[model samples]
Target chain A: MLAKNKKSLIIFIILSLIGAAIYLFTLSDSFMYQRDIGKITHVSEGSSQRTEDEFKNVDHQHEQKITMIMLNGKQKGKKIHTHNSWSNSGAFDQKFHSGQQVFVDLQKQNGRTTAEISDYKRDTYLLMLGWVVISLLILTMEFKGLKTLFSVVLNFVVFLLFIELDVKLNLTNFFWLFVLSAFIFTALSLLIVIGWNKQCAVTFASIVIGTTGALMIGVLVLNYTGNDLHYEALDFATQSPKQLFLSATVIGLLGAVMDAATDIVSTVFEIKRSHPQIDQKQLFGSGIEVGRAILGPLINVLLLIFFAETFAMGVLFFRTGNSIGYTFEWTMSLGIVQSLISGIGITLVIPAASAFAAWAFRKEGQVENN
Target chain B: MKTISILTVILAFLMVLVGGKQGFSAFFSVLINFLLLFLNIMLISSGFPPLWTSLFSGICILAITIYMGNSDEKSSNVAFLATLAVMVVMLLLIVPLDHLVQVKGFANEQSEEIEAFNLLVGVDFEKIAISTTILSTLGAIAEAAIAIASGLNEVIEQDPQITPLKLRKSGQNIGSQIMGMTFNTLFFGMFGGDLALFILLNKLHNSFGYYLNSKIFVSECMLVLYSAIAVILVIIVTTWLMSRKVRPQRSA
Candidate 1:
């Protein structure tokens, strides 16, 4: 058994390295479409830096003569040339170098084929990184990892379907649209991952109550406050940011909340299973203890992810001499709101789960007596 | 603003009402984490390099999450060490990958909003992106570390005679259980963060292929995958360290 474990570990390591190399370098060869893929062969030197008026900062803009060989399109295998310019900011533009695979629009002008860089061909890199992650998950957890991968993919599909249905059907009342989406996502993910069992049932119920309650309370507070929630921060959102933010809160909070519930419920149920005669009070107490233990780490998880996404923007705001309060209002407010709502959901789910476990076990105890 | 104030009040009230002393501590820790995040942003905006700021705050946040979450000295110490190791590994990986991927700076999606702002604040957006990725993985790492360390310690106390190898096995069991939920949390967090954007993307009728190649989608997926990998790293580190801890005790 020890030898087998060591052997599998070796195999996993070897496969990971080889897979990384193959996926990183050779993925371009596997695509079927012949439209707009090119491999950069040479890049000419860029010009020197120049200062900018805005922000009184140094900005550099230079155009490099990039030469590439087209891997697809009518000009397949033909050499092409284009000028790629970039700057210190590189916000909307980027510098390209040799060995980069980019999608290009082919132009035939004056008996010469010049290509316009459209976007980077990034699917290969994603595939490589994704391969590493999926392999690690499977290596660590085996069958369960496969199940997890399946559940996640299914959830992604459902999410895509939700997007399609909402847009195609032109569904309004985003409150209900997202509320219903939250429910469907929760039920489907839990069912596929954990299956329909007694423990799952308890987790499902607690999550439902916790999510809906959080949603309603958030909406209630918004209504009472006349709905001022820094919606302008969610720029480019076509829908109501209020509904978007609230929906994002529930769905965002659901996973961590579900995790907390499962941990507590499973602990309480474990106690009850081991000691069938244990009273509801003792079991309920255990659940709360478990819940409390999970709170800090779980809350941090939500806080850090949400905060990181906005940190750069907030910093930009601060650098521009925006007041802290003003910066917070514009850059960090929506994320903070999301985190606050999710934090509330996570905290509330615990006691609700603990109480449910105590009740479920007591009911089972009575059923056994009957 | 009113919405946030009300939500903050509601959150404070619910937290205090839930776990009582522990709930208050959890709430306090969250506040500290946020304050640190703000300080981190301020320091970077003032020309403190983002990479160093992130490393400093990352360790501080990891310590807060583990020590405050578990509250048991020995187990949390082990957790902190394990989380630190995983974080260092993640940092090394992220630096190179961030350069290779080039998903830094404001994405095209944010172009309209950022048109008026000056990006030449003398800060490298590439380094800032790395910092953000580093910060994003802390919670997951710290959470994974604490979960495994505490669970393994519990097993050791329960079975004082358990061998190091056996303890390692037990750690794997516990880590796998925690991982199921951790992966879900990370994945759904990604989905939830963009559910609205997804609706808009669909409305624009962008193809799946387009979404796949888009910088925003790739970076978002990369974040989720990186977090997952960090969790896996923490599990291994915590388990190995914990097994050694058990080994010393078993001989004595």
Candidate 2:
């Protein structure tokens, strides 16, 4: 058994290294860069000139070049320079100095790549920082922590896989798929962590009940409120507006709902395990208590993280002299709607998860006692 | 305040204060992460080698993690092993999924607006959009990896002689608790930003089915799913890898 464990460890390590290598290689230059020869064709200030009102007559024509150096690659060795152009919309706003080299993507002109002049001094430092941080995180965590990290990676792959499959198949009936995926995802994840056991089963059931209940409640509330659902803050969405909005609503609530469920079910289960004599009502009460304690703060964290992201847009809109109404209508207001939807989902999940957990534990208690 | 209560409050506050200070490094790490996104966009626009551009971003993030985390050698070594493990899993999952999902392009109003911006700026809006999706997931995945890794290490600190089964069990327990909250973190993290739009859409009196059909709504849904799946897999992979390192316990 010991030898088997060692062999598995060795295999895991070898596979991990290989996977890392592939990830690094593929991600090495997946970004599309634009090169500039230090020239500006157009500039818009205040509200971007490309307003919804003005979009009809928005002149779509421009030409310019900005010179910049490549901050990375074999091209780093060459004194490589290129000319880039801009169109009528106010996409590229900042100007570059002659000596200040910037990072960007190359545009193909007659099979030759040309620079599109994006920005000076790309924040490669930050990317490095992220990796380093991740590295440091794993090191501190040791082996088990390492495994947890691997699970996260695998989960992401699953997400990407499902997304691609849906897109390729063009499956319109995504809601069912989502529900099914949520279950599979939640179950497999918990199973791996908790292993094959009644405890995991209970937790899995709890997560489902919590997430589904919260989602349903959110759906009902949205219906009752009528259709003023706003998601205008999402930048560059340019997709089916209404569909995107609805999907975001469902997806948005899922996390909080799941979280609440996990928290309630696990905490209750722990309580039951530690105190076998604890009755249903007491166990239920403790679940509720834990849920209540965590809910408010969790909501707040979401709010802060979400709101702060829109700060730039808000400032940009306000700076443009747009009325508060216009800015809110087109900018961060959608974020508010998204937030409330999630908040409501979170609120519902707490009670529902706890309730389900209480009932499940009580049933289990009976089975064990019998 | 009563003396004991006061002392308790002081201690609690001190923990927050200390944690806050510690979190600053994490926060900086996050800030640098965002900067990398912006810079990646900028680099793509500037015509650098795409590989080098991404590499630069990755390197930058890596540096910030090292500098700001101020983690000691022992912790760094652990973090490396853990992150490597997770990254490997992330790659295994992400590569295949990318083949499956392809991250559909802007099919809504925002895409047009972005296109207008691109037309004006000569930027490849599609490229930007794809980059954004990838970058967005990166942060969430990285955060989960860090949190799980850190939590596991703390468990080890408490009992070095923890058996493989015991450690695995504990990791799962920890993962379970985290699973509950992390979704909230990811869900609210994604949804909170788009709240007003939902409320407004709700006011429009659209049917539930209709509301779900919006392009932006679908895209966001896609993102949420992506994040959730990522969170779930991370836990599994983490547990699997960690189990290998622990020494097997004898029958008691």
Candidate 3:
């Protein structure tokens, strides 16, 4: 264990060094629009103040002069002065303290350069947290942990590559891409994590069937209920809203379905392995029983995830005096529907996975008995 | 919303029909869980502290979920203790990460949506973000905790004389399997939730670096990572707790 920990620590340090090196080089020049990193050196007392009506109370805002040192770009090591507006609510306002890192946005007009503080530089913090997660995983599960991390990275790469290909091919039917990506993701992840095995095959089948069933049900329900898919809530859609909504549903249901499939398949496989004399019927029954035990909490997991994501918006709506009905309609209706659909998918996967396992593992169980 | 509610009603009825008493209990658990969440939101909006409200609702949801999901008191007790222990550890880890990340409030792009409302609603968005992170991860943590606890409990019951070393190994095996799927669940869930936003960035032609630096993107990434961490912690902690509790008896 000590040797393993030492090796992991070495790897961690090397990875961090590589990350820092990349960050340093990127700071000097990047393909994207340039922004300078700066450290706040000083902050002045309030230079101006304003008051506004906030809900049922009054809110005060103050403007302060901030001095920062440019850490990168052409203006490296230069001291720049900027103005920051701090508000009590901290909604759109950010308060800068001395020694805080910030992104300095530079604009040139009339041959003069003006620097303003755009936002806090959050990369370092994110990197720190990422390292924490990776280290914890490596220390705990060792080789399997490494494999899991590799698969996660590959999943993201595959997703990005799909998007790139879709853009290049000018694919108009995004729903197809969504479905294809979901399948590819499921296959790649299952194959990598579980390797080429019957369990992987069974779980993969269960996920695809479960997700498809849920998608069909979602479509049917949406059509019958006359609930207009709220495309407007998807604030960033530049493509067909219908396609986007459908894609979201398909992608969202993938994880829960995969989770259910894994749970059911693994439990049944274990049971069959230990109790080889058990018949297929009994194995299927046990699979269903295990699924029942887990189904409620699993559904709640998805529900809470979907609902809590909308909590901020929900609170904002209600605080603004919007009626609860209006708030629910505007802020949470989409998430609610999405969660329900995923929940249905998760629920359906139990039987799908149990049946698949029953069929796939039937021969092996009987072989041992014979 | 109305149609979805009606569909939910139908789902509840069908579950009871198909699953019998367990299904009905599950349905009730979901219903009460939703109500508790609603109550939490109401409390947060009514000037209660966001952190406390989140904690309160989290406990209530865990209690109700474990109670309804498990029939016996022993299982429920084990689930609750394991889940709560994991939650406390996650909360401790999150508080510092939240401070370091310092991601608060709506994204800059969301300003257009909130133009009509007062920007300064006197709510501390920083606190809101913390609570949101905690609440979002609570359900998954609880689910994983209960799953591991009950699974090991069954293993122990089957082999009352099994050595602790062997039981621990079984616990690790179960944890590994649970972790594999839960990680996927979390990853895809976040992916699906943010698909539109990704499309938005693509259409706007934002560079990869810029996308990485953007507040919304960073926030979402943090959320995904936080949940993953929580799930990992729950698996390890739940396994350890269960193994310790179900140690082999000497005279069995």
The predictions' CA RMSDs to the true structure, in order, are: 3.1, 14.2, 3.1
Q: How close is candidate 3 to the true structure, as a TM-score?
A: 0.92
Runs in model 1 deviating more than 4 A are A6-26, A30-35, A109-112, A271-279, A363-370, B151-170, B247-252
Interface RMSD of candidate 3? Answer: 1.9
Per-residue lDDT, model 1, residue A212, is 67
Name the better of 2 and 3 by lDDT: 3
TM-score of each: 0.92, 0.51, 0.92
- Give the per-residue lDDT of model 3 (tens digit) for B15-79: 56545687789888988988888888888888899888889888889888887876656656777
lDDT ranking, best first: 1, 3, 2
lDDT of 3 at A324: 88
Tens digits of per-residue lDDT for model 2 on A211-253?
6654565455556555554544355443445455555555555
Q: Candidate 1's error at A235, in angstroms?
A: 3.9
Q: Please, what is the whole-model Cα lDDT of each candidate in the order they appear?
A: 0.78, 0.48, 0.77
Using DockQ as the yardstick, the better of models 2 and 3 is 3
- Candidate 1 lDDT, B102-137, residue by residue in tens: 888777777787888876565678888898999998
Evaluate every candidate with DockQ and list the scores: 0.60, 0.09, 0.61
Tell me the lDDT of model 3 at A273.
Answer: 58
